[model samples]
Target: MKTLYRYISLELVKTATTAFFLFLFVILINRASQIAETILGQGVSFLDFFSILLKMLPAFFGIVIPIALIISITMVFLSMESNNEITALKSCGVSIKQISVPVIILGVVASAISFYSTMYLAPKSNVEVKRDIERLVKKKLTMSITPKNFSSNFPGIIFYVEKIFPQKGIIEDFMVSIQKKDKLITIFGKEGNLRTENDTVFLDILNGSAQILNWKKPKDFQFLTFKNYTVELFKFSSEERFNARKYQTLSQLLKEKNVESQTEILKRLCLSLSPLIVGILIFSIAVSLPRGAFGTGISLTLLTIVIYYVLYTFSKRLAFGLKLPEIALLPDILFGALSGLLYYLSIKEKLKIHTGARW
Candidate 1:
């Protein structure tokens, strides 16, 4: 029994590890072009691009580990059933419960990994990735801004320059338009210098003129001239930038009291436990199905993944839309109940088979 358990566990671990990396690689390849455009297009170095990719793994792990576990369990058990190995084990008095032990153990481990990734590592990585990208953007800002092209990278402001000397951090014929709630503010300068102080980027315009036009009264317009004027392009402060839920850690999320935070907490917990729920469900289905059900098993696995994620996404949207955090638990509850029912039926079938053989 020990040897059998070890053999099964080893096979499961090997297959699952392989599948996990393979799936991750395929997903990275699928997103390669988009990632390249985002990073390389920004003129970020290759090292920085690779670093961002590495930081992104935790987010992928939270999603990919459970998927790999389910696929591995289905493939292993279905292969065993197809080759009559399950029947041979059963004939030797090895019960379905015994066969399930390895799967349960693997599920627990995978669930732990998923929990860590989602609750801790993923959030931390998200913040780091954001910070890194922000840093790269700030570093490459001069290079990214094209002369004679109006750039809207800064929120609520559009700026154009007739000429730019990136090395000298100087601009000629700098023009900026800013939209306000009640009016439009436009600034023009013959020369300007770009500089950064801490987290803020500032443009100091020389010999500039400002024009303000009121939206409510088209005839009401104000114009002013100045020797020097400064415009704050943007800021990257942590308090304002990192306030999103995705950038928050588990402890940080726990301290917040709001509908979104509560929903996020529930969603993370449910996602963490999904692997065990899905593993048991697939295991029961694998054991109960007929020998020649390999195609059915694969189909079922794919369908289960699709259904689970769809339900999860819908529940999250419903929860946020209705401001009810409990709605987020719907997917896990439904899947948990279905898993229990299928497990019961599989055990009953095994018991009946044993009794008939004895008779």
Candidate 2:
């Protein structure tokens, strides 16, 4: 019994490790591709790109590890069932519950790791990534602004770029709009060039026009056309709202006590427990069905993972939109209860099989 238990434990762990790496690899590639377009286009140093990648890693693991665990355990057990190892073990007096504890323990460990990542590492990493981005935007102005979209990343200002030329190092159709507390400024240019001094970004525009308006007096507006224009693109400020709720630690979040912080806390809790809950659901299905039939387990596993993530996304939207943190736990609670019911029925089926064979 000891040997059998050890073998099962090792197999599950080994399989889970493989699944974890595979899924992590896929996620890394996908995530890299998504951000690469925006960040890499700037022609930044490779070290900066690598730093960004590392900072973003912990933020995703909390969500992906659970799916990896679900897939790993389900795949291994279903393979065993397909090969009749489970049937043989049963014939030799091994109970499903007895053999399954190892996988469940592994799932628990995965759950704990997920919880830690979501509650601690994720928030820290998010803050680090935000800081990294803020620093980068300040350090490299031309590379930081992605052309063709409105970006509010700059402190207290929003701007849009129409076209960017890396080879010629020119910006075409340059337009900037800035609104300060008491003043509003708008500038338009046919073309512009960027200059960096120490850590500041300066935009040098030729054949441009500027309009100034006093916000307090709407009727006071002045427009001027110029042959050459110069302006500071972005200045780094510690007062920027980079301390977002998502990037705050648990203590910080609790102290905020706002709907946003409450939403994040519940979302983390739901995400942390999702693995164990989904694992149970997968186990309940894998145990009762014949594994080799149409790869139903794989299909269901994928479906469950998709549905699980969708639930979180929707829950997050609802929680923030409706100002309700309780809604975040809806999916977790519903799936957990369903998993229990399925597991109960599966155990009953196994018992019936055992009894019928004796008769």
Candidate 3:
């Protein structure tokens, strides 16, 4: 019995690990493709993009690991059944319930990990990643403004320059335009440059000329030139405060502050419970597999995974839309009960006892 239990546990672990890496590779590839485009356009190194993706992995794992575990367990059990090992065990009087003990233990561990990622690691990474991106954008904005290409920093305002000595802080053949209600203004300069002071950005033009065209006056072409002219930099919006859902951890969700928040919290908690339910469901399906060909067992395993995912998704939607309090447990309970029913049915079949049994 010990050997058999060890064998089963080992097989499940192998299957789970294989599934995790396979799916994780696929995820990384997809993310890499998107990152490639972003880096190429922004002239950023691949290393920087990879760093951002690495930081995002906790959230990704929170979703992928659960699905991988479910499918892997199903596949492992079905494979064992197809090989007749389960039949041999049964003949030796080792019950299906006994075989399921290790899977249940694994299920509990996975659930705890899921809860930690969703509540803690995920939110922390999200906040930090946002700050990182914001900093990158500001840096890029400062470094990118140069002469030769037309820049539309502020809409309805255009900047053009023929030559720029960035190190010396000077520009030549510079032009600036501003358009407003019934008026168009244009400025030209022999030199211009950028200035930053006290958290304010300014564009200073030297020896520049401005022209205004007013629609109301048919002959109005007002023009002005100055030794030095400055325009305020376009301001970036400040980061907003963290909302209840965005940064709240699982522990906070369990506290359930208000009516709406309570529902959300319950929904999140229920998602954490799904792994246990799925593990039990896998056991029930595994025990039901008859001594069969590989195709038969694998097909049934796939079907069980599909059914479980459908039920989980449906319950999650109901939790979110219907204001179902503590509704997260609903899917877990439903699947767990189904597992119990299947186990009981398996026992009935093994005993070969019906309504009228011969003593």
Reference-based TM-score, model 1: 0.84
lDDT of 2 by residue, 156-246 (tens): 6666788987544578886788787798898898998876676566788999898999989979899999988788865555465646677
Candidate 1 has an lDDT of 0.84
The worst-scoring run of ten residues by lDDT in candidate 1 lies at 350-359
Ranking by TM-score: 2, 1, 3
The TM-score values for the models, in the order shown, are 0.84, 0.85, 0.70
Off by over 4 Å in 3: 142-240, 252-256, 293-317, 347-359
lDDT of each: 0.84, 0.78, 0.68
Tens-place lDDT per residue, model 3, 100-152, is 77788778887888777776888877776666665554444323444687877
Give the distance in Å from residue 273's predicted Cα in candidate 3 to where it truly belongs: 1.6
- lDDT of predicted model 3: 0.68
lDDT winner, 1 or 2? 1
Model 1, which residues run further than 4 Å from truth?
Answer: 142-151, 159-175, 180-183, 187-194, 204-211, 214-230, 238-241, 350-359
**lDDT rank order:** 1, 2, 3
**Which residue pairs in model 3 clash with each other?**
none
- What's the true lDDT of residue 203 in model 2? 81
